[model samples]
Target: MNEKFTGIVLFIRPHREKDSLVKIFTREFGTKMFFVRGLQSPNHPLKKHLIPLTEHRYWGTINQQGLSFLKEGQTHNLFRSIQSDPFKQAHAAYLSQLVDASIDDNSEDQQLFDIFEAALCSLNEREDARPIQLLLQLKLLRRFGLRLNMNSCVVCGSSQKIEDFSMTHLGVLCHNHLDTDPNRMRLSYKQIKILQLFNEIKLNQLGHVSISDQSYKRIDELIFMIYHEQVGIKLKGESYLNQLYKVADQLKVSKIEGT
Candidate 1:
């Protein structure tokens, strides 16, 4: 018997001649691979709802392992803004792919589900959604059993006067302990504050994040370095995001020089 389930489509790929395979993060069963029949056909009913990064309710067979079968599906949120914009599409791809890679198959995590859902909504609603993306990445770090100590110095465990960040220690360092690691990176107070703000941000109630592009670039660099050294998972969208942002930065420089 088929039952109704809620899921956010992570991706869809052509399986054979006419069929396709879709990976969805279901609230009930975590991440699932559903075998979608005749999905390549133009008249398929569920094709619209099965788009990557959209949320939907579907009638499907729930299996403990292996591919499940989808009978029908309905759109919950198409994320039309993300669908229409190239930049938002890039962000969605990277965000969804990151979450998919971090979680194991069939693992039940309601918190992750809510975070991902809120992230999509935030991206759809806001023009500058990079802050929300950073927030998601920071929180998702714990899902991999990794946490960056933003509160205090990683060496002395002091919560006073944090002045620098250490890639080697994977946390902030106090003024007193800045020299504890020879590889500590000098960080401006603004960059340090932004990192703290990222951890404190509530995704469900997010507002216009006011961040200067300079600060955002620095913080993005720190997070990317940490993910590179620790997470070590090369996602398909990562390279695209890097290239896209690099081009965006160059454009901004050109504009500034022109003015």
Candidate 2:
């Protein structure tokens, strides 16, 4: 007998004989993979509902491999902003990959699902989604038990504030408690607060807050460090971001010289 579910499609792939396999991030069951036979046919019930970020109510059955057979499903929300914008689409893909890679199979995380939904909403509406996404990723990593100690010194736990931060220590190393490590990056108070605030805010309330360029850079650095520490790899989109950063820096330099 097949079980039924309500979920958002996180990823999709073509299967054997024109069928499709979909990885759903569900509301109840965490993440699941389902097979939709004859799904490529235009008349197939689920054909149009197969796109990424498409939320659906699924009627399916669980099999021996934890795979489900899709009997029926209906679209919940066709997010026009996310589906229409190419850059937003790309960002969504990147975020999906990160979540997929970070989480293990058959594990249930309701909190994570909620976080993802909030992230998707933020992506659709926010003007500065990159910084928001970066903040979300950092918070998500911590929620999964990878806490980045941004407050005080990691070595001495002093309240002296973070003077210099590092990807190596995964947080700030206060001046008084600074070890002999020469590979640390310097960070300001503004940067440290932004990283901390990302996890602390309700998703909908993010609109009320704004970040400075310096704080954004710090969050970016912290995000890169978190990815390296937790995922043990670099994000594919990071090089392009780095190039953009270099270009922005050069433009700023040129403007400063002109003034």
Candidate 3:
């Protein structure tokens, strides 16, 4: 019997000469791998719908052992605009890979699916994808139960001014407790406020908030550190993302110099 699923393609790998194995994060079934025969064929109708970050309606059959076989698929949203820009494309790749690595197979989480959908749509529409990326990472971290306690000092439970962030304590450290962890990263009150904003706001409501590049960098550093120390998974796309950002910065500099 065949089952129908609507999901985004997270990752794809070549299987033999003519087939491909795809990892899809579905709203109904969470993450699942599907075997698609003739996916690499020149005339395959589903070829265009198999790209990473593209949403599709997948029709397939699951074997008794629980492997999915793709019968047919139709595109839901190709997000062509995201593919048109190299920077957006790289970020999309990063997001897809991150989600694919972090979430377990057959683990259905509708909230995560919703967040990823909103994030991909937002990235396709927004001029600057960094802020949305940051927001999405924060949301994912929270969803994974690795959330940082920004509400108060984790060490002393003080809601007063936070002076630093401690990976050991898993939250902000007040000035009084700053000495408790020498390895803590110092954070200004403004930075703490920005992080709080990130935690409180929804991905779709990010237009009302603005973040500086310096602030984003700091937050990203902290969040990536948290992922490393807490979650212990290194995102495979980080190096490529760094290269893309460097190239984008150079292009911006060149355009500014020309003007």
Which lDDT values do the candidates have, in the order given? 0.86, 0.72, 0.82
Using lDDT, give the best candidate's number: 1
lDDT of 1: 0.86
The per-residue C-alpha lDDT of model 3 at residue 241 equals 83
User: What count of clashes does model 2 give?
Assistant: 2
Candidates arranged by lDDT, highest first:
1, 3, 2
lDDT of 3 by residue, 50-146 (tens): 8888899988875434668887888899888888988888888888877776678888878788888888999898888887777777877855678
Clashing pairs in model 3, backbone N/Cα/C closer than 3 A = none
Model 2 over residues 63-178: C-alpha lDDT tens digits? 54667777777877776788887556666766776776667766777887877877887787765667656756766675456777766677888758567766666666877755
C-alpha TM-score for every candidate: 0.94, 0.81, 0.90
Cα lDDT for residue 145, candidate 3: 78
What's the distance in Å from true for residue 155, model 1?
A: 2.1
Error of 3 at 28 (Å): 1.4
Candidate 1 off by > 4 Å: 253-259
